[model samples]
Structure formats: C-alpha cells, structure tokens
Target: MAKKKKKTVAEDDLSAEDLGVVPEEKKKKTTAKKKTSKKKTTTKKKTTKKSSKKSDFIQSSCNVGLVGHVDHGKTTLVKALSGTWTEKYADEINRGITIKLGYAEAAVMQCPKCNRVIAEALANLLRKSKKDPKGHCPDCGEKLAFKRRISFVDAPGHEILMATMLSGASLMDGAVLLVAANEDCPQPQTREHLAALEIAKIENIIIVQNKVDSVGKERAIEHYNQIKSFVKGTIAENAPIIPTSAIFQANVDKISELIEEIIPSPDFEDLNEEDFLFNVARSFDINRPGISIDDLAGGVMGGSIISGQISVGDQVEIRPGLKNPDSGKYKPVITTVKSIYEGKHSLETARPGGLIAIGTELDPSNTRTDQLIGNVVGTPETLPEVKNTVEIETHLLEKVLGAEEDISVKPIAKNELIMIVVGTSLSAGVVSKIGKHNSVSLQLKRPICALGGSIVALSRRIHNRFRLIGYGYLAE
Candidate 1:
C-alpha cells in the first residue's frame, strides 16, 4: 500500500478512526497536524434507541499509560489507538510536547469475523463528547464487539514534567513504554519513566518499538536489542516488545490485544467498599462564559477511584481541599455527589478503574482551572485527616537518573527540601529528622491527604530542576 494518498483524521468533530481510515501524509523533514473546531457533544435529534441504550450502560475502564522519552511517539500512538490526540493545551500543541498529564479513552473492540481484539480508533474523546458508539472492523465490514474501554494516560516525556508524569502514573493499571527506533534506546526519560513505573509498582508493561516506518530493518532490529538490554532484570524484563509505526497506524491491533490479555481490569467487586478512596487529578467548571447563575452547573472533580465505589447523592469530602486565603489554612469541603461521568456517559455509580468526573454541589468558581486537583475525595467522616507533616520509610537508588551524566545518589540531609508525590498529589517538604531505619520526618509546605502505607515518590532538586532520587511509603 502506498502512503501518498492516505488521509489521516483530524482530532476535532470525529468519533473514531479505523484501519479503514487513511494515515496522514508525511514529509521526510516534518510532521503535520490538523486542528479542527472546538469539540461538542450534542447528539442529533434523530438519535437511535440502540445508541441511547449503549450510552446508558455502566462500565468502568482501566488505565493504560503511554510513557517514554520526548518526541518518541507516545501521543502518536495514542492517536492511533484512539482517534483523538491527548494534547489540548496551546503551549503543548505549539511546542509539540506534552507538558501536562494528557488523557484519552479508547475501547478495545473484538472483530466478530476474526475474533481479533483491536484498536478503538474511530471514536472521538469520551471526555469531549457523550457518545462512544462502537465501530466496524477494518478487515471485515462486520460490526465489532466491545471488549473494554481503557483510559490512555499520556504522561509528559520531557524531563521538566517528570513530576507530572509520576502523578499520572498513580492512575494507571498498566503502561506501554514507547521507544522510537530512530533514537538510541533508554533515553533519559525512558530510563527515568521506567524507574517511576517501578516505584509506582506497575508490573504490567508493554514496550512499543515505534517509528519502524522511519528506520531501516537492520536499524530497527538493533534498536530492539537495545530495548531488551535496557529492560533486562528490571520490572519490564518479561514485557513483550511490539514494533509499530503509530504514525501509520501499523500493528495497533497487536497492542490492543495485549492490553486485553495482559492488563486485566482491577477486581472491583473484590475491593472492600469500606476502604473508599478517590485521587483527584483534575477539576473543572464546565459552564461557558455568560451563563447565568441559575443555569450554571456545579463544580466538577476529575480522577479515578482507588478503591470501593461512589454514587449519585452520596455525601463525600474533598480533603486538603479549599484553602483559606487569609490564614493560609486548608480544610475539607463536604458536598453531595450530584452526578458521575465516565467520559461523556453519565453514571449513577462510579467504581475504581478508569478516569471519571464527580459533579459536586459546590460553586463552579471553586473548581475552575483545576483548583481542587491533587486533593483526595472520599466518604465524609471516614476520609484521611489532612497532614502538614509526615514520616516515611525510604528506598534510595544507587545512581541518579534524568541527568546527562551518571552520579551517585547522595543521602538525605537534614533541613534539605524535597518533593514528595503520592496518588496524584505533589508537595514540597523540609527534612526535619532522619531515623536510623532509612526513614525521615518531613515538614510539608503544602498540606496533603493520603492513607497510611501509601507509596511516596521522592525527588531532590538538581540544577534547579527536581529529579527523582528514590521512593518510600508513609508510615502505618
């Protein structure tokens, strides 16, 4: 097949793309992006009953991460797997790098004809629209069966956004590590991200040897060897490596198949509802400009539930939530869950798995511009208490990562400042005391709400930018 006549679908006003869809035309020296109008979710007046019924079904999706070095095709792979690109910020779009944590949801569909699970490439973002109608197999015109929806958490690969990536990893159930065949294996972020995944304790990983379209056969094979060598004896040592040209939507079905086979959804039913927790990664005021107060919707909280379940009308608390500007003190915000959404579909109940949004009864101003991000949401009276300081058990790696040169990790010194990340929350703290058992007490600059025994990612400022030094857990 020739590439010259192919037409790649643009991000806006689209549902999904299929193998039946064409790839974007490419130039040897440049990559092209087509921007469409702002996304809207209004369904046609002639909407069918089946579509409405499909929309009403309640199903939770698991998270799958797209992580690796910058310019290595993580976003492109997301575009291939899910028709919409994840980068929405003007800076991210203009710079061609994911600066914030970008997310897009794609459903894994199985072809009835071949029984092959494949990419859900035709649907537009569930985040942007309320509809996620299924698509047909590109192989056969026969309709495809819906397997499961997996949220693609597109972590920023730039060294500066390492903290952002770590926060996003807290939501992921599994991840696909993207490595471009055109570059050397284990680029700085490639190594750092792998370490972060290890710290996050994510064991399910798939290596995507991307850009085979740009590299020759010999070069591609050599890069494969490099990837294998890089992951040897690491958490991803047994992970499968899938070669693909995400730019051309090649071998995406194989990636989808593995996501279904290897990355099963969390056993939500087995999780005790008594241990309820939600990690807030984003917050928003969905009201448009010029909307009257009576017509304005309540504020929204976006994240994944870590355990148990939540529902409409349930009373919940947002901890370390709103800050009192005058006194600079933080307190929990208790509110009712007015609505729950997985993508565009409104749900009566939200469980642990993929990304979701909880519509609360608070003023839209409170949630505007992610004011409530990095906070925890849970049962009102049972929520963890907000803390201004904490003690943690530590685990340090021998060498520092994300640096140009290898350097030994230095011991934590008293009074030194460090960044600590836990379940989408990030805080800077001063080391107040160092215990004999690799533990340190920290006086936090910003208050945080997390359960005991939660994983903590520790980073030290290096050359004015923080680099991950090690990880630890909150004391029980």
Candidate 2:
C-alpha cells in the first residue's frame, strides 16, 4: 500500500466536498445551521426564564361585600356608587329584592371640590405644544381614575334571607351598613346584619344614612344621631355617617369620599396572609370552554376575598363535604384558576375587598355548594388545614333562641351539626365544645370553608328554628 502523504493542517480539515461529498458552500451552510440551532436553544431557555419572572411579580387583588336591610337603598346605593345594576336578574328585579348575591363595581370619582382639572388640562396642552386650551374650574371637575377600582356584592336583607346576608357579609373586608334616614330605629335585618358583622369581626364600617334627600337636614341630623347611638359600641361606632341620596345624587360625593377614607387601597399588605380564605357566596355555570367553560358550566365561584389575594393560574384545592366523605377522609380536589373577573372586568389578580369570579377546573359535581374553597397555589407549607375543630365566640339574636340555656339538653350532643357562615362560605358542623366563656368549638360535620383566625358565625338548628347564637375562629 502506498504510504499516505502526511496531510497539512488545512488539508486535514476537509470540507464536505473535499472527498466529492457535497458543495463547499453547502458544508459551510450546514455548519452555520448547527451554530444557529445552538443559539436558538440558548435563546429559548432565556425566554422561559424571563416569562417566569414576569409571572412571579404579578400579585393578587381584594374583594368587598355589601350588607344591610332590605329597601334600605342597598341596591340603589350600589347602583349609584358603583354605576352598575346589581339586581339584573329577572327574579330579583321583579321581586324587588336581592335573592341572590348581586355583584357590581364601586366606581371611584374624584371629589369635584378637590380635583385639579385645570392643572391636568394645562399639562395635556403643554405636552401637545398647544396653548389657549379650553379650561374649566379644576375644583369642580371630578374625574375617575382607571387605577382606583372597587367592587361590591349587594346582599339581600329579607328577614327570611338572613342566612344569605350572613353569607355575603362573611366575604367582605369592610362593610357599608345602609340605614334609611326615614326609619326611627334599625330594622330587624339591620340589627341582624350588624350582629353578623360583629360576629365576622369586620372592623371597618361606613354608616350611610341613605335617602337623606327625602328628609330635611334637621331630620337627617336626627336620623344620623339615632344611628350614631345605635352603633356606639359596635364597629360603626366611629364610622363616618354620611347622609346620601342616590336618587337626587345629593351628598353622593360624600359616599365616595367616605369610601375613599374607609376602604383601604388594594396595595396594602394583609397582615394575616397565613390564614387568608375566600368564602363562596354563589356558584353558577357559564355558557362559555376549557376551564372557564368547564368552571362556568360546572360552577362559577363567587365570593369576596376575606384575606390575602388570589390570581389567575393559581392552583386551588377544594375540600368537599367539610367533613370526611363516606370514606371518613376529607376529599381534596386541586384545580387552577382558568379565569378571574371582578364584576364584569376580567382581571389577572384579585385582592381582599372586591367580588371575585373564579373559573376553576373542578368538576361541578365533585365540588359541592358549601365546600371549603382555598388556594393551594402559594406556599403549601402555609396553607390552612381542613380542620374538624373550630373555636368560636358567639352572639345570640333575641328573636331566635334566647341564650346558652336554650341549647337543647337532649338529642343535641356537643359536636353536633350546626350551621355556620364565614365570609360567603356556609355549611353545617357539629358543636365540638361549648366553653364557659361563651365560646364554642365546632367539629364541623363537614369541612366548612374558612381561613384560620377568621371570624365565623354559628347557628344551631333547634326544632324548626335556625338560631344565630355565636361567632368563632378557626384554630389549629
């Protein structure tokens, strides 16, 4: 065999065509393609990393619920302040009562006497290099900012629908207790709702003496004083009592002002994130696909964020039956938020004082009406447990069962089934312990929904009557 001549450095690095395999340009092109492939792989990794960071920065928002007496202008006031019709349902409109939870947005408008319209107009013209701009009294021109968003859940106030009212009230951060100026004293529902608020431990309240336009200033003042005296030791004791007229829009600005003063911004951090829970006031199927369609068709989770925040794409865990199912084990189903809407506006995140509609991937059949709804989307380590025992501090409404002595001596064992409402979540649990301190521990027959540390109401079933007796908190 002839000895192969030693190839030079350039000769050894042969192109594809060196051996008549292909064109030299094609070989170069192939090599370039390989390099580009590598670049693309590197670029793809970078893009994924960037996308994740963006997702991490997006936080959740809040929710609020409206509670008060029927015909107290709760619906009208909601329509006026939120600029949305809460009672859109035919049944609700026809009955002139909020049978179900009616959701609306609370629109924030600037104080006509405080906004700087002229300055804003001048700034706009300056940017456009235009002068002699048409001007108006800045002090009188109130504008709505897109950023300042609020929501409300108009709850029913019918005497028979106290459960519904309590359900709605449980999900609120603060409450706007509407009392008509025309009434000499608080209605039964008014006192009931106030009691419910106290049970839920809702600390922020703005007492609105609605229909003030119907009453002259002198009478309105008297009405205000009466209400002031009524709420003296309660949450509304120090609450601003603004006289308002939704029909005439008189003192309407005052409602907005009070809301601004009372409703804390959504940006504020909740000190109680670990125990954050949202109660579902209403669940409906939508005619929409995927998770949203499934969620809507299955069930639209409606409630207020009692604490913490919830965002789209969050993985939530549903504890059905509050108690262990037939298997004596709590059933937990995990799902993601397909979509989130506040009133009608689609949102990426929701805070603690607005209404939230969560389209979930859960099968409606599996998730019962009053199951405990919570997000397993955050730190699982911090997620609350589906506890059987809950500690409570309760208040008994006089018309119903009178006192602790009224608790049935027989057939009603401690830890027996009793209805409880916290936020919008409602379910029946067994009374685990009744303390001498007027507190009780409920070993919920089912895992009634709740956030630890959240205030919950207890109503025991005695014969044919449902008695609102006490309030409690979820403990470890």
Candidate 3:
C-alpha cells in the first residue's frame, strides 16, 4: 500500500494545484520551499517565520467584524490591520463601498525583545507606515513574532445593505462598530448596525471612533459623549470606545489590544467532533476564463465552522441548495472536501473559529456568482431539516432602525412580506399566522436549512428598502 502524501501550501502562494495552476516545475519549487521553510523557522529567534506554511503556524482563532456606516473606514481599518484589501469586486471598487461581505486575516504577534503579546495590527500598521517596512514591536523595537491569528469580516454599512450586513454578522464572534469622529455620532446605519449585532447576539463588541485625525479634541470629546449617550442601556453600552484614525493608522494598537482582551475564542475542545456544521458565507468558482476542461478546478465555499471539525476527505452536503429547474424545488448538493484554506494557507483539518474556504468536488458553474450563499453544509444524514416555514417568537423594537427619523414599528400584519436573516441565509417570508405570545409563522419564499433556536433578524420594506425592525428566535 502506498502512503498518502501530505500536501502543503507556501504562505505567499495560493494552493496552485487546488486551482489547477501547478506546472511540474512549480510543484518541485513548492516542495523545495516547503523543505527549506522547516529549516528556516528553526534558524529564526522565535520572532518571525517568513513562511506561514511552517509547522508551527496556527490559523486565526476568531472572526472579528469590521462593521460601520458607509465610507467610515471599515476597509481602511482592515487594510491597516491585515495588510490585505477586501474590495475585489468590480462594482464594489467602482462604488467605493462594500457590497458583498469581505474577509481578511491577521496574526496576533508578540515582540521577542519585549516578551509581551503586543498588538499585531499595531505592528502591521507600523510595517506599512513606518521606516522599518518589516513589522517590529512598538515597545522594545524588536522583531515581532506570531502568537495567534484573527479573521476580520468587513460587512457593508449602507442603508440598503442591511440584510447583507446581517448575513455577515452570523460569522462573527465579535464586532467593531466604526463611528466616524468627523461625522455626528449614531448615524442611521451606525444605530442599525449595532442593533443588527445585538440581534445576532454578539456580546463582544468594540466601538471605534474612526477618522479622529479629521476632528478636534473638543469635537472628539463631544462625539465621545454622544457615543456614550447613544450606547446607554444597549448591549454595547459597556463596550470600550477607542478613538481611532483608520486613515492614518492611529490607535490600532488599542483596537488590537481590546480585541484580544474582549473577544476570547470559543473553547470548542469539548465540542462533539461528530456535530459538524458550517455556514456558507461566500462561495466562488476560482477557474479563470478559457480554462481547459481537463484542468478545471472544483467549486470553493468560504465560511466559518459552527461546531465540530472537517477533514480534507470528508463528504459534505449543502442543503436548501440549488433550485431544480424542472420542479423549481430546492435540492441538496453533496461533494467531497478536496481542500481547505485559511486565506492562502492550506490545512488538512479544520475546527471552529476562523473563516475557512473548503475546496469541494463540484462543478464551478453551480457555485459561481455566489449561487450557493445562504446554504448550510454538513454531513448528508446529519444536517438539520430544510424548512419552508418557521415559527418565530417575535420581539419587536420600539422604532425602525436605519431611518432618518424615529419611526415606530408596526405590529406584524397578516400577509406582510418581511425579510428574515437566519445565520448566513436571507429570505423573504410572508406573515402567514400570528398566534398567541407573539408567535409568528412565516412562509419563506426560499427554503433554509437551519437549526431550531437560531436567532433570526427581521426587517420590513420601508420606503422601498428593508429596514431592520427587530429580532426573534426560532420557536421550539
């Protein structure tokens, strides 16, 4: 019997073979790099590894959301932190705002000289903005070393993109709500984004007073008061507010330090390994135009694992999947996990926490253009039941969120079509029956495979836009 070869990826290179881009010479070069990296880390003074493919590397331990109003420096802050830009879509680039959910990962680095786990984003900011180009410790000026990693989910903050933001929130373990110091505190989307986080039940929150470079200390102090007033009695009332300048890379150390302190990763060590469930945040067909059929790569899905672990060879099923053309009914798609990725880094096994991409054995066409968004993936027989209807124990807010002026939320009316966000899934549901105890039955336009007791965000079409109204829990 032949032993199975362990495949690895270089930190700087994407999984070339996974994307069908590996030439024979490139494969040998990659193998040589892998061999060299093992010895390379050994030579380093426990400070830095030029290659993340080294055995000592670890993936991001949690997903932190970079969320706020449009043009409020969410992307700028992500770039300041991770050194990776999230805007890739043509429309997003032209519009200069996040439309689809964006993702990036950064390592929490410690300075070997300081012997303290200093803020890595601070190191990243210094690397990008300072004379040393290579990142170093802010304290002792020594080379920074890897400690842990954190993934960032950059969600759109436009008024019309509330559903998209809610969908992104489902993947977050914590969130950083950006409020521009130059603008008035509690902008419409700022209020709504915080409410959305509350609906999603994210307790680890950080409020970033971004763009502080454009404001005076007096104005900044007033805005700080407004921020304090705005968050009073809310879930984020106690969330530390860090005044920042995302454009100039100021106070990122504070942000990174608070993230480490507030957002502790879930201790999934005791979680049952059999209960494997993953939410599909984004899916793509990575094959470029005019690729040969023989070398075409399979579909890829990016998301975070909610529970258990997934292996490279595991068979996974996507539920509430593609609609059957003949009957217009949804059907599940089963595929094998061909490869897994944390950014460009490949992994043989994955557990819950960081955002991951699973390369699957499926046709690229089916997964292109995010056709598989809002689908739940799990083992064939282990996935939760698909539901066309759900009963939610509704909790209505006092007023509609994301509105210019406060608008009182009307009670759920019969036959009222509303937008519902469950995990990464978003669908329109008609209020079919309103029973006692605010139990509302919704006939979903699209079927969703979600577990019971999941938190669902509700929105109403106000002025031709879906404004967040409140949240509810799937009734038992």
Clashes per prediction?
8, 32, 0
Off by over 4 Å in 2: 1-64, 111-113, 116-147, 213-222, 270-277, 288-299, 306-312, 321-330, 349-353, 364-382, 388-417, 430-445, 449-452, 461-465
Q: Which scores greater on TM-score, model 2 or model 3?
A: 3
Ordering by TM-score: 3, 1, 2
Estimated TM-score per prediction? 0.86, 0.68, 0.88
lDDT of each: 0.81, 0.59, 0.83
- Checking candidate 1 for backbone clashes, the offending pairs are 15-122, 15-123, 15-124, 16-121, 16-122, 16-123, 17-121, 17-122
Best by lDDT: 3
Off by over 4 Å in 1: 1-51, 122-134
Per-residue error for 436 in candidate 1, Å, reads: 1.8
Error of 3 at 241 (Å): 1.3
Pairs that clash in candidate 3: none
lDDT for model 2, on a 0 to 1 scale? 0.59
RMSD of 1: 10.2
Residue 7 Cα positional deviation in candidate 1, in Å, after optimal superposition: 34
Candidate 2, residues 64-134, lDDT tens digits: the string is 55777788888877765655666755566688888766666644434354552122222222232343333
What's the CA error at residue 441 for candidate 1, in Å? 0.4
